[model samples]
Structures are given as structure tokens and as C-alpha cells.
Target: MTTPGWWAMALCEAVNDKTPLAVAFAGEELVLFRNAEGQAFALEDRCPHRRVPLALGRVVAAGLQCGYHGWTFDGASGRCTQIPNLRTNEPVPPRYAARAFPVSEGNGFVHVWLGEGVPDIDLPTDDYRPVGQQFTGSTIVNMSHEQYLAAMLDGPECLLNFAHVRMTDFFLGDVRKEHGRLVLERGAVWTTQILPSNFVVDYPLIVRTEVPVQGGSIRVDLLSEDETPLISLAIASGANRRGTTSLCWRGFVHAEVPAKAPLRWRTARVWHKAPFTVNSLIDGSAVAALLEAPSRDLHAARPPRLIPVSAVV
Candidate 1:
């Protein structure tokens, strides 16, 4: 498989007084935390000697204390440096080291590399810029990585198909976010926006959701085809008080159609019993890729790599 760039397959979050934070972006467990000065670090979640989840341990004295045997490792390196039983303070045991990951810190969140040494740090600054977006509140759904992405910027059809947005009843908005114009490939310019409540998730802030739109340099306020603004569907979400929420934005322009999906909708959630805010994995190349069907007999150990169509674009 062709290895994608950094942002294509990564996620970041703060330690939040919780060391050994369970990270799923990588297929394995990783212990991530901030030190006294608030610098973040990531290490293989396992301890070298017995492979215990170091995350279960605590951060004290600038190092991580393994929960099981009280073995301590330095924050910068996974080397086992301190053993309470030994009278002599020694360098970390020669071979007792765990895998360490290099981290990039920005926008109040921490990003890591899963493939090899340092991937691109050249990510979107405006992408994570807080739009102060608001929604009904906070709730995490079990959608796969793909659906979470498509639900975001799949453009017009997405409202009617996945998001229950009816084009006839409600118009959609700008297909792209920030800087780039959401125009077609050298075609006639058509811009759109939706009438959902104005909730935006800009960093460090939470405001109502008002779908934004831009096409061929013209910005259009998305609304219903009836010509009335349909901004009532909006709901607000909780603000990131810790100022450490990791925000991501993806841009996908495909010459072909979207990736294969299980069920395509014509009228939105007529398939489901109720409306859900978070994206759902309903049998498509979306989140199901993480389900790992061939291994239905066994449990998976790590997160699945999502094929980013934007990376192709």
C-alpha cells in the first residue's frame, strides 16, 4: 500500500490529567501525556519487560511510573531509568526501552507519526482555527473513520444522503472550508449553503452552526429551495474549556464518484429509526473498514487506516 502523508492518517488529543491516554488513530496502544511544563510525549503503551499498558500508570517526578511493578521511564525516552528497589540511581536499563513516537503540537492538540520517522508537519493552520462552532452538545458515536470524514465535506449529496438534508426542502452550502474556492473543475460556478442552525466548531470557541459555502469566488448562504433561509436545524455543542480539542479539516475533489458504500440514501434517515448527530457506520467503505470483517472470529488490536480521498485529490 502507498503510505499516505501525516495528516492523512493521524489524530491528536491532550493528556487531560490522564496519562497513558488511549489513542486509536494508530493501530496500537500509545501512552500520551504532558509533562510539568505542559510538553506532550507519546510512547508505545506497552512496558518493555512485561508489556503492561503504561497508560494505567501515573506521571510523577517528570517520568511515568509503571502501574504493575512500579518501573519508571523517562518522559523524553522510553528507557527504564529508575528502579525504586535498587539503591543506586542508574541510567535506564540497557535493553529495557519501549518504542517512542515523535509528536507535533499545535492548535491545543498533539499529532503523532505512525508510519516512520517524521511525516509532514505542513498541515492546515486555518483548518484547526476555531470557528467557535456550537452544536446540541457533546456525544461520540461509533462511526468508522471514513464516515466521520465523508459526513464532513462530501458536498451537496451528503446533506440528503447521510445527514438527512433534503435538497428540495433545504439547500446546502459551500462545499469547501477555508482559502480554496469550492468550484467545479473548470465548469459553471454554482455555490450552495444549508439552512441548519448556525453551529461552528472553531478552536477555543463554540458558536451556533451555520453552514458556510463558497463557489467560484462567490459566497452563497445555503438555504432551502423554497427560498426561505433554513437555519433552524442548528444546535450548539460544549466549548473546549481545556483548549485542547484536536480539530481536523479535509478537502476531497474526485474526478470519479465517491468510494463504494453499502447503502446509498435517496431521502435520508428513512432507513434509521431516529436522527443521530454523530456519523454512523452503516455498511460502507466508511467506518466498516475499521470493523475488519474477515477477522470476525477474532478481536482487532489497533485502529484501521482510512483511505483519504482528499489525499488522492
Candidate 2:
């Protein structure tokens, strides 16, 4: 089963150099590099010849030159262009090609499509600022891509839930304080919300993108109101001996930590059939409705309409 969306593979600045950078997505290893023309390309990391990682090689005039035996593959088509050991008239077989993936650069991110055939949905072009500033952090989590999406979709409402908020003060600051209305907008390109007014410092507009990775994991991107990148996170499934969840936060806010902190309270476990609170149910249902609509019609509008949750207390 393939998820429908553009998954961000790496930051634009990270792949600006000629060296091939290896990245893992959806369980497959891919090497990213820039050609002589400064265009980015992603190809299967393994060379068809000796099974050596193409990333271990260097980018040459023909494309990525394997360091093992001077085998060169085209960056765009992943076709084997040269083999130093081959005779002058020896014809290379058509099968000698590295699998290539479609890559596009936008919003300071290099995105790749993992689904089959041509991409029907357009790449995200939010004009967001490049990452690497202001509260930027990332950590791998033990959860599936679908679980993370459902959790984030209902996150605001879950945070606002009276019982859950009271029980978990560690996650949400202080719920006793009165908060303003939470506004949600669903549109052609994105779904966003305005954080509650009350707080010492509030990140007003929260723009989030949940991208599905190959191995059922997820890569989440969080942006601020002005579309400034905040956090780039990758959540993947793994074994937990204690049967609990974990969260590793790194930033100015939560720098200090303990050696053996309890992971259960820190991380919220996302289950497939987990029960939702009243507030979250409402929020998740609305989000589902918006997602079910036609994508073309959603993109045709100038700006998305903001719908406030009236029933939330």
C-alpha cells in the first residue's frame, strides 16, 4: 500500500554539493547528488555490478563514478555510461541501470515520490523559509506513519481535552489558564491552525506536513506562521522492551535531561484502534471530511476558509 504525498528526503542545502549523500526512505536506500548543471538526482544507492554503494563513489562528468571499478552511471537516467574494464566495442546490457526516483526541490526541501507510475498530485510549494533556525530539532520515534498522522490531526483537540490536559501537564504547559479560540483552515495545499492566544510565547500559525516513509514510518515537517521551518522529524517503528513510547526533544527549551527518565509519560503511544476523546473526535472528523474532497477543487480557491471549533471549551 502506497501513501499519497510528496515525502521530503533532505534539506536543499544539504545536497548542494557534488558528493553523493545516502538517505533511507520507506526501507529503501537512495543516494542524492547534484550534477554538473546543479540539478539534484536520487538513485538507488547500490551499483548493479558489484553491489557496492554508489554513494561510496564520486560524481564524475558522466555521472556517479563507482570507486570500486570506475563504473559510471548517468545521474538522470541511472544508466551505466562507462565501464573502465569493458572493451572498446563491448556493448553494455540494457539491464545495467540503477533505479532512479523523481526528485523536485521546493520550499527548501528535496521531495521524492514513492508511489507507482507518474505523480498525480503536485509538489508542495509553500514558499516556506529554509530549515536550520529557531527551535530546530529532530528524533526518531517508535510509531507508524499512519499513527503519527492521526495523532497530529487530532493533536490540538487532544491537547484541549479537559481530562487528558489535566492528566498530562508535562506535555501541554498549563491548561488552567484561559485560552483563545483555535482556528482551523483546510485548503488546496495545506491544513493549518492558529495556536491558542493564551501563553507566555505562542507559535501563532502552525503548518505541519506528515510525509509517509517507505517502512511505514513518517517524516514530519513543522513550520511557523510566516512559513519558517521549525522542526524536521522522522518517526519509525522499532522494538521497545518495556513496551512503552519515547520522545527525545532537543532545543533551547528542553536541553537539560536525566539519564534514565521514564519514557511512557514523555511519549504518547499511538495505537491503530485507539479511542479518541470527545474533542479529538470532532477535530479528526472535520479533518477527514476535508481530506476526502477533490484535490483540484481545493487548489482552485484563492485562500482557505477558516473554520472555528465552536463546541471546544
User: Against the true structure, whose lDDT is highest?
Assistant: 2
TM-score of 2: 0.50
lDDT of 2 by residue, 144-229 (tens): 33333344333423311211122111122211111111112211111122233343153333434232212122333333335443
Which stretches of candidate 1 lie above 4 Å from their native place?
1-13, 124-126, 131-140, 147-313
TM-score of each model, paired residue for residue = 0.50, 0.50
In order, candidate lDDTs are 0.38, 0.45
Candidate 1 residue-wise lDDT, 104-126, digit = tens? 66543455544533456553222
How big is the positional error of residue 255 in model 1, measured in Å on the Cα after superposition? Answer: 34
Q: In order, what is each prediction's RMSD in angstroms?
A: 14.1, 14.9
After TM-score superposition, the amount by which residue 124's alpha carbon in candidate 1 deviates from its true location, in angstroms, is: 4.9
